[model samples]
Target: MDTLRYELVFSEGTDSGSSAGDVVTVERTSATGPGGHPVYTDPTGIIRAEISDQGEVRVLATGGHQDPAQGVRARPLPDAEERS
Candidate 1:
């Protein structure tokens, strides 16, 4: 088993002001394969988030590769005026 480190950066958004940075740590584990074989892997993943100037929150992460399958997409956090 091993530990993985990841860094996340948040740039200024259309509404949100800005953010410093985020650090993440992940632990690996082993599992059984389709054929009942042992497989040791640490699947890649992606973290998605939305931030608003008013501090509204709507965020989530997908446990998988950071590739196309991750569907890494995000839109500006809606402003109070747009929430109506």
Candidate 2:
């Protein structure tokens, strides 16, 4: 129900990969599990931002059926960091 999307803004980068402020979208999907199931769980065990890459500034912990890359977690770093 809640469409969450980060307002991406490309600052600077080469012509190789994603630039700064790419406006990536965070998708939420129907997850069939004890966490989501109200009867099975209190709906609290759902994992959120815990650990991540060392250099990543703001990582997108995206997943669920809404995304094409389901199950594949991606933490797209800044444009400058990608170069390195």
Candidate 3:
């Protein structure tokens, strides 16, 4: 599995209200979604995202409550770490 790290920025608002404008770590998973897009997971394990080859992000719910994050932007991170 090829692992990569990213910084996810939420400028708008999220499902969970607390995470708006929060920056979170997102790691690439071995799994792939539609069109062979790579799947990523947050440190909280509540946010699952599918990033397309074109850099489009599709957030997936884990059937639980998560901190809200509005307009999201994904940035490549040199290192990956869990943060609250």
Top candidate on TM-score is 3
What digit string (tens of lDDT, one per residue) describes model 2 on residues 5-59? 1222333445555454333322222433233321111123222221122211232
TM-score comparison, 1 vs 2, better candidate: 1
Each prediction's whole-model lDDT (CA): 0.31, 0.29, 0.70
Worst 10 residues of 2 by lDDT: 37-46
Name the runs in model 3 displaced over 4 angstroms. Answer: 1-3, 13-20, 64-70, 79-84
Q: How much does each candidate deviate from the true structure in C-alpha RMSD?
A: 15.8, 13.6, 6.7
lDDT for residue 6 in candidate 1, whole number 0-100: 19
> TM-score of the candidate numbered 1?
0.20
Q: Which should have the higher TM-score, number 2 or number 3?
A: 3
Model 1 misplacement above 4 A = 1-45, 61-84
Off by over 4 Å in 2: 1-3, 13-21, 29-57, 60-84
- Summarize candidate 3's per-residue lDDT along 10-33 as a digit string, tens digits: 665446666567677888988886
Q: Report the error of model 3 at residue 14, Å.
A: 12
